[model samples]
Target: MDQFTINLLFVGASFAIYIGIAIWARAGSTSEFYAAGRGVHPVTNGMATAADWMSAASFLSMAGLIAFVGYDNSAYLMGWTGGYVLLALLLAPYLRKFGKFTVSEFIGDRFYSPTARLVAVICLIICSVTYVIGQMTGVGVAFGRFLEVDNTTGLLIGAVIVFAYAVFGGMKGVTYTQVAQYIVLILAYTIPAIFISLQLTGNPIPGLGLFGTDLASGEPLLQKLDQIVTELGFNQYTAHDGDTLNLVLFTLSLMIGTAGLPHVIMRFFTVPRVADARWSAGWALVFIALLYLTAPAVGAMARLNITQQFWPNGTDAQAVSLEQIETDPAYDWMATWQQTGMLGWEDLNGDGLIQYYNDASPDMQERAAAEGWEGNELNNFNRDILVLANPEIANLPSWVIGLIAAGGLAAALSTAAGLLLAISSAVSHDLMKGQLTPNISEKGELLSARIAMAVAIAVATWLGLNPPGFAAQTVALAFGLAASSIFPVLMMGIFTKVNNKGAVAGMLAGLLLTLLYIFLHKGWFFIPGTNSFTDAEPLLFGIKSTSFGAVGALVNFAVAFAVSKTTTPIPARIEDLVESVRIPRGAGAAAADH
Candidate 1:
């Protein structure tokens, strides 16, 4: 079958399964809609959490970043996995023991202030919205290529499909649907990795193949990649040429951001008991580690494969000819991807060949002069396309290519569903029902939750069109915001006796400052062209905007403690509440009301 037809069959079948599950398990009550009726099995919840946690960023974008940015981007793997440990061990059991339906609800009750709840709702929405944009970006890319449509049209179609499932199913629907998605995505990701790894290194395991010697050069795969990239006038693939301080801050931001994410936190609320929440966290880590271990191998192998495609004989030989690109089956992936407008090249010197080396490299200037080349011919090769395009670039089977189409969509849609659920819950449950309309019935709340999800989808689609960076980088920014505004307060609420005023002030101080710094660099609300500065030359202390989340978290801590010292102490009853959450001696069933 043709590639497009094959892709349609796989993606359509997966969507059918997800939508069918949503229909079968459609939520009916507030408890069901908000926390899956608090009866999800620990193992099932863990798989679902893994699917939710490993969003478009983890599945489609992180490997792309690692492929291009090299050793520096290893921070993504470390920070994200470490952050899960913090959430599981440090936060999940306690939050479940506290027995709140949402993170905002927990913050509101723990701090004993409606205002604190309101602030938390706002924080959750901001973080969730920002996160959904990355998912949208990934959806656009996957659909744009597979559906043979432009990015915008693909994005619009994806938004509608996601909204239908999310609004119909709510938390109960999403939890189970995510489990199926996890199976599809994991199989899709690793099957191709095993194929590519065996081809490149004679090893079936992608992770082991990453460190194994290249079949052609008989050198370590990383060493081969390092030599290949450097000769192409790019930085050595194994080199760490980034700012140490910024790398530290960026990783710290992702770590905390992963913990602060409302959707991931909401998974713990769905379990039957506090121990279940802990077991769920542990199992989620195991599921997540599967993808994490394979990502570096995918990145390195993909980089090496692509570089060799450009220079089939070697980097010392002539680049791919226009005729081969036009007619060869091996080069067919290029024409298909170029339609997305994210990949392209030009024969700047009209030599009938596309030379893709880094023309700006000082070491390449002499080569350019000798060859009489004008400049580098490759243009607008977006980093986000690396992972999605890898199977095709390696000339894998049509079925493998089709499976990747399904996998990429699942990766993006699963996380987007979770994030939208978080946003809808915060709006309808935490903000509207709890504060604005305290007397609203459960039916009214449910209707509003679906409506809120629809609105969020619209907003995310619009912003995704003008995304400020690649999928993973854009996601890191969202993490920064969450780390700054949400993580510290959640930590303090669990570990300390910080007061309501302190929580509110700390949240605002961290959120506003981080948002402002991000806007100055990324753009005003990520509109694309309104930015006054670039990340390369940051405005202060040589820190990139993506790295500012760690600083923002510190500011939140400092501001919270300072404000608390000058404010009233926690009430006696609240103190006892804190003790109960910490000690984790609780009833079997979680109380329904927050």
Candidate 2:
């Protein structure tokens, strides 16, 4: 079969499995819908959590970001994965012991204030919604490439599928579906990587092959990649040269944000016990590490492959001729990617050769002038497409290409479903049943959940059709919102005796300040025309928008403490709640009481 047909087959088969599971496991009650009736096994819940947390950003964008930027981007890997350790140690077990269906519920009950809960709900919606927009964009991109549809059409299709499965299965349905998704996405990610690694390094395992000797040059693969990229004026593959302070802060921010994200925290509610929650977090990291460990290898190898393609005979030799690119089947990858409108090239000087060098490099400029090359002609090469283009570039089997297509879509769709679930449950369970209509019937609340999910999907589809900016940047805003607002309040609720007023004040200050800072840098509502600083030149000590989450988190902690000093302390009962949460014994009975 052709690559397109193969891709369709893989994606269609995977989607079929998810929908089938949703049908088999349809949620029927508040417990099932919100927490899967608290019967899910720890290992199963962990796999589900992995699917929910990884999102499109981890699967599609992280490696591409690393490949294009070099070791400076290792912060993403360390930050995302290391955050789970914090989740396990600091948050997951206690939150599960709290025995709540939602993160907001825990806040509201522990703080003895509906206002605090409402603030948490607002934070959850903002963070999850912004994050979902990025996932939706990934869905559209995946569909457009594999199904040959436009982004808008692909987004609408993806949204409808998500609504059908998510509304029907709720957490129960989404959990099982996500377990299947994790499998598809992992297989799809690793197989092609293994092929490419073995081709270059003569080692079977992509992870080990990254450090193994290159088959062609008989030198360490990473060492050769570092030498070649640096010769072309880029950073070494294994070298780290970013701001150490900023790198540490960014990694810490991602960790706190990960532990605090409602969608991820809610996964713990699905398991049956506090001990199970701890085990689930460990398993989730184990599954996540499967991809995280492979990512550095993929990034390093892809960079080496792309750079070597440009400088086949060496940096001093002439670039590959257009005739060679047109005639060679190996170069067909460029033609295929061009059809997606993500890859393009032009010969500005009328030379048949294509130059893929940084135009700003002084030595490269001098060499270009001597060679009579004009301005750079490869006008646009999105960093996001590097992984998607990798299997094609290596000329892997058509089925492998198809599997990757399905895997990328699965990653996007799985996370979008999880986020939409969080949004809908917050609106229906927290806002409607808990606050607006405390007497609302179970069936009515379930209906409300479905309606809210549909509306959320509609909004996400619209935003995805017109994505605000880069995937990584939009996701960073979501993380900043979660880190600054939700994380501190949750921490205070568990670790301190901050009064209701203090918690509420801290949440509002964090949410508003973080949103304002992000808007100043990323435009209000992310519209293109309104911005004061490029992300590169953000306000407040030249911290980029991506790195501002840590600062916002700090601001949240400071404001919460400042407010606590002036207010009446939390009730003694609330202090007991914190102590009760710290221990594992008697948690099951406490949850059962709720």
Candidate 3:
């Protein structure tokens, strides 16, 4: 089959599977819609959580970041996964034991204040919406490239599909669909890496091949990559040159953000018991590691492939000819990806050839002057396409190309559906029924939940059509919000005797300060032309937006402690509540009582 036909078939078949699961496991009650009735098996919940956590940011953008930036980008790898360690140890089990449907519910009950819950709900809405926009954008990109449509059309189609499953099926439906998504995505990611690894290093395991010696060069894969990249004016593949304090803080932010995210936290609540929640987290990590371990390999290998393609005779030689580029099947991935308008090239010097070397290279400067070259001309190569295009670059079979298209869509759609579910439940269950209309019937609540989901999908779709930023950029905001606001409040509720007044004050301080700093850099609500500092030279001690989340989180912890020490302590009964969450035994049947 042709690559397009194969992609269509695989992507269509996967969508069919997801819709089928939604139909088979349709939700019936508010509990089912919000928490899958708290009956999901640990293994199944683990798979579902993995699908929810590994959104387009992890699947599509991560490798690309690593590919272009070299080893300094390893912060993303360690930050995202290491956060789950905090989740598994300090947060997941206790939150599961709290037995609540939403993060706001816990905040409301723990502080005995409706105002606290309302603030948390606002924070959750902001974080989830920001996060979902990135997924929607990812869905559009994945669909546009494989389906041969414009990004707007692709986004509309994906939004309709998300609305169909999420509005009709709720969490029960989303859970089973995610399990299938996890399978398709993991297979899609690994198959290409394994093939590329074998081709480059004669190793079948991509993860192991990353550290193995290159068969062609008789040098370690990373060592070879380091040499070439440094030779081209890029940093070494294993070198770390960014600010060390910021790197550590940034990693910690992502970790705390992962633990605090409501969508991920709610997955733990769906499992049957506290121990199940713990094991489910471990299983989630294992599933996530399947992609995480392969990502660095894909990034490093793709960098090598693209570099070697440009400098066929090494960096000292002339650029590759346009005739060679057009005729070479190895370059076919470029043509395929260009249909989406995301990857482009131009021969700036009119030499009928494209030069892709770093123009800033001191050696390249003299060579370019001698060779009558202007500057690097292969511009606008979107980082998000690297992982998706890897199979094609390797000249893999058409089926693998199709599988990757399906996998990218699966990764994007699965997380989009999960985030929509969180948004809907927060609106209907936490905001509407819990506070606005307490007397509403279960059936009425279910109806409102589905309606809320539809509205959320529509908003996400519109944002996707004109995405404010890339997936990684948008998700960074979401993490910053969660790390600053939700994480600290939840930690204090479990570990300390912070009163309602203290918790409320801490959350507001954290949320406002983080939002202000982010807005100062990213523009108010991410709109253009309203920023005070460029992202390249941000304020707050020169901390970049990506590094601000950890600082915001620390601000949260500090404020919460200072406020709690001066105010009235937690009541005796609230201390008992804290102790109750710490224990694991008899936590299989959690009570809603505070």
Specify the highest-lDDT model's number. Answer: 1
lDDT of 3 by residue, 1-594 (tens): 677898999999999999999899899877788889889998999899999999998999999999998778888889889988988988889988888889899899898889989999999999899999889989888888989998888888888888888888888999999999999999999999999999999999988999998887899999988888777666777888888877787888788888889899888888878889899999999999999999999999999988888878776676688888889888888888887888888998899878886788888778789888888787888898888888888899999989998999889989998899889999998889889999889999999999899889888887777676878888988998999999989988888888898888889988898899889988888888899997678786778876777788788888888888998888887788788889986675564442
For 505-532, candidate 2 gives per-residue lDDT tens digits of 8888888988888888878888887988
Where does model 1 exceed 4 Å of error? 587-589, 592-594
- Give lDDT: candidate 2, residue 143: 86
Q: What is the TM-score of each candidate against the true structure?
A: 0.98, 0.98, 0.98
Model 3: lDDT equals 0.87
Query: In model 1, which range of ten residues has the least summed lDDT?
Result: 585-594
Error of 2 at 330 (Å): 0.9
Candidate 2: clashing pairs of residues? none
Alpha-carbon deviation at 432 in model 1, angstroms: 1.1
The TM-score measured for candidate 3 stands at 0.98
Give the clash total for candidate 1: 0
Clashes of 2: 0
Note the residue pairs that clash in candidate 1. Answer: none
